[model samples]
Target chain A: MEKPQFDLQQAISRSIQDLYEQGTITNSDRHELQAHLEDSAEGLITTGLSEEEAFLIAQKRLGRPELLNEEYAKVNHNLRTDKTWALLLAGFAAISTFIALISYSGSIYYYLLERFGLSNYTWPVVAFLCLQSTLFLFIALKKREVSNFLRDQVEMNPLRSIVFSFTLLALVKGMQIAVLRYLPKSFSYPASTIYGFQGDKLIEFATYVSLFCLFVSLLSIFFSLRSPTKGTWRAAFEKPSIAFLMLFGIGTACFAASTRSLSGLLPVPMHFTLFGLVYLMGAALISYYNENSKLHLFFFGIFGFCAELGVGVVADIDRAQRGIGQIYTPFFILSLIVGLMAGWYMGNMLRGKDAIPSR
Target chain B: MKEISKELMASSLAPIILLILRRQESYGYEIIQEIERLSGKKLAVAEGTLYPILKKMEAKEWIAATWKTGSTGKERRYYALTQKGHIELDSQYEQWNFLHDLINTLWKSPNLTYNRL
Candidate 1:
C-alpha cells in the first residue's frame, strides 16, 4: 500500500489556522507564515514526501510554535505595563524640575524685590544668578534618577534626549528675547529693571548666558546625531533635529526681521511669536522624549500649555481692563492648540506597538 | 552535531516550535517529545527555559496558544503556528541553511599542501 502524499499547502494552512485560533499568531504573524511556507515548499517537495508532507516536516523541524507566541506576549505585556510606569515616573521627575525652577524664580524675585528693592541695580543680577544656581542644583540632584527613568522609557538612544532638551531650551529663550525686542513700545517694560539690574549690564549678562547655552546645545546635538553608541541622545536627534533646526533658524530670522523693521526695538508680536515657538518646541521635545509613554506627554502638554497660557492672559488682562482690546487671546488660543497637537502627535509617533527587547 | 549554545538554542527554538505545531495542535509535553524524537534526543530543554521562550514569541505576535483538556482531564496549553510564525520560520530556515552550508564548506576544505617531496 502506498503512503498518502503530504500536502504542504494544506498543512501550513491548518497550522496557521490553529495558531490563530490559539491566539498565538497575530495578523502580521499570519502573513509572515504564509511567506515562509511558500519559500520552504520547494525544499520540502524535493524530499520524498508529497508537498504537504514536506511542508509539515519542514515546519516540525522549525519547532513548537506555541512557545514563541507565549514568550512574545509576555514581553509585550511587561513593556506596556511595567515599562510604561517607569516612563511615567521619569516624566514626573522632569516636570518637577521645571516646577522647582518656577518655585526658585518666585522665591528669588520676591526675596530681591523685598530686600534690595526692585529698582536696585544689583537685585536683578543677584536674582538671575540665584535662579540659575537653583535650577542647576535641582537638576544635578535628580540627574541620576531622571536619566535612568528616561532610559527605561525611551529605549532607542540616550544622548539624543539630552541634546533635544537642551536645544529646545536655548531655541525657546532665544526666540523670547527676539520677540521682546520687536514688540511695540507700549508692551516694552524694562525687563532688566524688573529684575533689578542696570539695563546695559543685564543685557550683556543675558547675551553671554544665551550664547553659552546655544554653543553647548549645538555641540550636544552634533555628538548625539553622529554618535556611534546609538544611545537615547542619538535617538533624540534622529528625526526631530531637522524640524528643530528649521524652526530655530526661521524663528531667529523672524526675530531679526522684526527687530530690523522696528529700528532694532523688539515688538509685542515678535515676543509672543518667540514664546509660542519656544513653548511649542519644548512641549514637542518632552513628548518625543517620552514617546513610549503617553502619560508623560499628557502631563507635559498640560503643564506647559497652562504655563504659557497663564503668562499670555496676564500680559493681556491689563489691556483688557482698560478697553485697549484683547490682542493676546487669539494668539494664546492658537499657541495652546498648536502646542498640544504637536506634543500629542509626537508622543503617538514614538510610542509604536512593536515589541522591544526584554530587559 | 555540536551542542548549541543557550543563545543559539533560544533563537532557533522559535522555528522548531512552529514546525512541531504544523502537524497538529500540541501541549508542552507532546511538543517536547516531538523535538526530542526529531533531534534524536540530542536536545532536552528544561521547562523553565521553554515556557519563557513560548511567552516571548507569543508577545511578538509570532504564534498563538490555547488550553485544551488532556486525556486525563487536565488542561494543557497547546500552541500552533500562525501565518506570521510560518513566514519567520521560512526566513530563519533559509538563513540557517546558508550559514550551515558555508560553515560546512569551510570545515571540509582540503589541507593546503602542494607537491611535497
Candidate 2:
C-alpha cells in the first residue's frame, strides 16, 4: 500500500498557478502570492498540523483563487491595461470581424453602399483622391506648416510607427480595391489583361514607367516643399529619394538575377515593379516617422513578411477559385534581403552628417 | 461570542492593519496571523480580503512596502506605516474609541427608553 503522504508545497503552487492561468493576476503577482501562501503553509504546519491538513487549511484560508485574483486585479487596475493585452484583444477583434465580413459580404456590402450612399469603391476613390489633392495643396500652399508637422509630430515608438504605416497602406489598398471593383466604370483606364508573352512585356514596360514616374513626382514634390536650408548638393544624399533609388536598383538587380528560377513561379518583372514601389513607400514612411536604424530594419522585415503573406493569400484564393495548385516559391527570401539592404542604406544616409538629422 | 459583521469588520480593517504596521513592519501572512492570534480566532479575517485593503492603503501613501527574506527563506513583502499613515491610524483609533464608548454606554443600560417622533 502507498503511504498517506501528500506534496503540500506542490498543492499550494498548483492552486496559485490557477489564478495566473485564468489571466486574473500577472506573473509577478503570482510569485508574490506563492511566497505568501508558502509562508502560511509553513506556519500552519508548525502549529501541530499534518502537511496535508496544513495545506488544506492554508488553501481554504487564502480563499478561492478567483476571488483573490479579482482583489489583486482591482488593486493593480492600472497595470492591467498593458499594451500586450490590448494587442491580443485587437487580434481577436480582427479575426471576428473578418469572419463576419466573409460570412455576410453580400448583405453587408449592399447595405453599406446602397442604403448608406457610401459605395465602397466610390467613397474610397473620392476620399483618397481628395486626400491626394489636399496633400498636394498642403505641399504647394502651406509647405512650411506641412513640413514642420511631418518633422515634429512623426516621432513615435518604432514598432507602433511601423504598425501605423502598415495600417495606413492597408487602408490605401482597401480604397484602391473599392475603386477597382465598384467604380471601375467611373475611370476609362484600360483593364489589366494578363496574356502570354507580348502582353506580359507590355505590363512590364507599363509597370516600370509607372514606378519611375511615381518615384520622381513624389521626390520632386517633397524636395520642393521642404524648408530651404544652406547645404551642398551632397546634402541630397539624406533625402528619401536616395534610399528609394538604392532599394529600387538593388531590388531590381536581385530580381533580374533570380529571373530564371522565379519565372515559373511569378510574373517576375511585374512583381519586381510592385516590390520596388512598396519598398520605396515603406522606407520613406519609416524615415518620416522614426530616425531609428534598428526600427528601419524591423520595418523592412515586417514589410517583406507582409509582401509574402499578401502574395500567398492572393495565390491561394485564386487557386481555390480556378482549381489549380501553387508551386513552391522561395523568392520572398530575396525580397527580405533587398528590404534589409534598403533599410540599412536608408538609415546610413539619414544618419550621415550630410543630412540634418531631425530626430 | 457572535461573529463580527462584515460591515463592522471592513470598517475596522484599515485601523487594525495600520496599527499593527505602526507597531512593527509586517507582511500579509504574518499580519493575518498576528490578527488571528490577538483575536483568539474569534474574528476571522480572510487573507484574500487583506491584500486589496493593503494595496489601497499603499496607493494612498498610507503604507509603503518592501520585500525581504523571511525566517523561512522565502521572500516576503513587508509593509510599514508612512507618516501620513500614522496620522490616519491615530484618527481612526479616535473614531473607533468613540464608537466603542457610545456602544458600551448604550448596552450598559438595562432598559432603553425612546420618545415617539
Candidate 3:
C-alpha cells in the first residue's frame, strides 16, 4: 500500500488540540491559533505554493506544541491552574458552612419531628433524595439544565461565588426547617415503626441525609470546573449504578466482616471509610480528563471532605464527640491530598490504555 | 541594509504592535503583514511567537480584541488599541526619541563612537 497522505487541516487541528491539552492554550486560544494557522497557510498558498506545501510550511512555522505552550503559559498568568488553591479553599469554606448549618438546624428538625406527631424524621429526607434523584435523572435524559446551570456557575465572580453558593445552601436547609417547624402545632406524637426509620434512628438518618446533600453540592462545584456538557451526571466518573454497586458491595462486605466496628473510631463507619478508597479510585479513573486543567484533583478533596463531614454529624450525636483522634479534621484533608495524588497517578495510567488520545 | 538583531527585533515588538493597533484595529496575521510592510521585510518576526506578545499586551489592557466578520466573510480576532495603549505608545515613542538622539550625537563624535564600539 502507498503511504497515506495526512490531511494537514486535521493535523493543524490536532496540533492546536495538543496545545490546549498541554495547557498552552484555552478554548479561545485554540480558536485564535487555528485562525492564525489557516490564515498563515492561505497567505503562503497565494504566494504560488501548492496547498500541501503551504500547509506544511505554515504548520512548521507555527511551531511545536511544547514551544507554543511555553509561550502561552508565560503570557497567561491568570490561568485557572493558578487558582487551584483558591478553589480548594472555597470548597473547604462551603464544607465548613454546611457543617455549621446542619448543627444550627439540628434542634429545629428534632422539634418538628416530635411536634408533627411524627415518629419518622428521616422519611421526609428520603423523599427529598428521591425527588432530587428523579430531577437528576430527568435532567440526564433531557441533557441540558445541569450543564447550563454549571456554565452559569463558572461565570460567577470567584469571590462572590462562595457567598452565593452558601446562601443557596442556607436557603435550602432553612426552607426545609421552616416548613417542618411551622406546621400546625396540634397533632399528638405517633406510635409507629412503619414508613422510613423510627425515631430512635433519627440521628443516623439525619447524618446520612446531610452527608448526601453536602456531597451533591461539593460534586456540583467540582463538576462546575469541567467543560460544560449536557448533564451533571455525565461528569460522573462511574455511573451511579456501577459506582453504587461497587461501593455498596465493598462497604457492606467490609462492614459485615469487621471484627470490631463503628465505635472505636468514634462515629466513622468502616463501610463509608471503604467508600473513601472506592471513590478515590473512581476519582482517579476520571482524573485523566481533567489532568492538565486547574483544580488538579482538588475536587477529589472536596468529595472526600464531604464524606469526612459525615463523621462530624454522627460524632455530634454520639457520647464521644470529636471522635477518633486529636487531628481527625486534618486527617480528612490529608486523605484528600494523598488519595488524590495516588488516584491521579492511577488515572493517568488508566488514560494510557484509552483508545482516544489523552486531552 | 543590515538586519536588526533577532533579540532587538523581539524586544521592540510590543511597541510596534501598539503602534500598529493605534492606526486601526487588525488581527494577528494582518498585524504581522503590516509590521512586515512598514519594515520593508527587514524586520522578520517569528510569526508563531507574535501571538503570545499580542496575548500579553491584551492582558495588560494595552489592546482589546473582538471577533468580527471581515468583508471576506471570515471571522478574525480584530485588536484595537485601548486608552492605556495610546499612553504606552506615547511613552515608548518619547523613550525611543531620547535613545535615538543620544545615539545620533554619539555617532557624530568619532572618538566616542569608536571607543563605545
Candidate 4:
C-alpha cells in the first residue's frame, strides 16, 4: 500500500495550539509563526514537491516545537521573577523613606526648641514623627506580599519606572520645603541678634537646596535611561550627559555659597564679588569639560577646584556681615538652561544611529 | 536522497499547510497519509513534529480545529483554513512566484559562454 501524504497545515495548527496551551507563545506570536509557516510551505511546494510532500518537509524544517516552547517558558519565567525583585526594592525604599522622615522631624524639632521659645511644641512634633514612622512600618510589613505582586505587574510596563522615580523626587522636595517653613527664625542665624533673621532667608536657602536636588534628579534620569544588562561597575559607566555634571557642579556651588553666607556675618560687597567669581569659575569648568582634548580632564579638575574656592569665599564674605541673600541670578539661570540643553544634545549624539525612530 | 536543512523546512511549512487546508478540512492522520502518498515517501514527518505545528496554527487564528469521531469511533482533531490563512496564502504565492522568476532568469541566462567553446 502507498504511504499516504501528510497534511502540513494540520501539523502547524496542532503545534500552535500546543504552544499556546503551554503558555509558550503569546496569541500574537502564534499568528506570526503561522504566517511564516505558510510562506515556508509555499516555498517547499515550488521546489518540485507535491503539496502534501511540501507540507511534510516544511514541518520537519521548522525544528522541534518543544524546544521553541521551552525558550518561551524561560523568557516568561525571567519576566515573572524580575517583577519580584522590583517589588522587593520598592519595599526597602518605603522603609527608608519613613526613617528619613523621622530623622528630619527630630532634627527640626530639636533645632526649633533650642533656638527659640518653641519647647512647648516639641512633644507634638515628636508624636507626629512617631505616628508617621509607625504608619509607614505597618504598611511596609503588612502589604509586603501584595506590594511585590503588584510591583511585578507594574514593572512589565517601562513607563511606570519613570513615574515612580519622579514621584520620589516630589515627595523628598515637599518634605524639605515643609521643614524649612516650620523652623524657628533664630535657628537660621544666632549671631545676627542685632538684626532678626526673616523667614524669607529660610525660603531662599530651601530654594538653593531644591535647585541642587533638581540637578541630581536630572542626573538620575539620565542614568535611568542608560542601564546596563548586569554588573555594578559596568552600570556606573552608563553616565548621563556631560551637561548634567556641569549643571550639578554650578548648583552645588550656589547652594554651598548661599548656606554659608546665611550662617556667616558676611560683607555685602565681598559676597557679590564671590558670587561673580563663582560664575566665572563655573563657566571655566563648563568650557574645560566641553573640550575634546587630552588635557580636558586636567582642566576640568583645575576649574572645578577654582569654582569651589569662589563659592567658599562668597560664603565667608556673607558670614563676615551676618547677612543672607539670593544665590540664583540671571547667570545661574543661563548656566542651568545651557547645561541642560548641552547635556540633551550630547546624549542624543551618543545614542547615534539606533536612536532614530522607525517612523 | 539528501535531506533539507531544518531552517528551510520550517520556513516552507506554512505555505504548504495553507495550500493543503485550502483543499478541505482534514484530520491529522489523513493529512499525514496524503502528504506521504504525494511525496512518494520522500518526506516522512514524525507524529511529534506534525501535532505541534497544527496546534500552533490553530492558536494563531489562521485555522480552526474541532474534535470529531472517526470511522473507528475514536476522536480525531479536524482542522480547516481560516479567512486570514487564505489571504496569507495569496500573499505568499505572489512572493514565491517572484523568487522563482528571479532564480530562473539568473540560472538560465543565454549569454553565457563555455571555456571549451
Chain B, per-candidate TM-score: 0.82, 0.88, 0.88, 0.83
Model 1 DockQ (Cα-based) = 0.07
User: All models: lDDT?
Assistant: 0.52, 0.58, 0.60, 0.53
Backbone clashes for every candidate come to 77, 1, 0, 61
The CA lDDT at A154 in model 3 is: 36
Per-residue alpha-carbon lDDT of model 1 for A259-283, expressed as tens digits?
2222123565664554455445555
Candidate 2 colliding pairs, count: 1
- The best candidate by TM-score is 3
Winner of 1 and 2 under DockQ: 2
Question: Model 4 Cα displacement at A72 (Å)?
Answer: 16
**How do these models rank on TM-score, best leading?**
3, 2, 4, 1
What is candidate 3's lDDT per residue for A243-302, written digit by digit as tens?
443453343223222311222434554434543464465456556555542253444344
For candidate 4, the TM-score is 0.30
Relative to the real complex, the DockQ score for model 3 comes to 0.53
> In terms of docking quality, how is candidate 4 classified?
incorrect
Model 1 global lDDT (CA atoms, 0 to 1): 0.52
True contacts kept of 2: 0.87
Residues B1-117, model 2: lDDT tens digits: 348888888888999999899899998888888998898877788887798888899989999988888876778888999999998988999988998987886788747664411
Whose lDDT is greatest here?
Answer: 3
Report the lDDT of model 4 for residue A34: 61
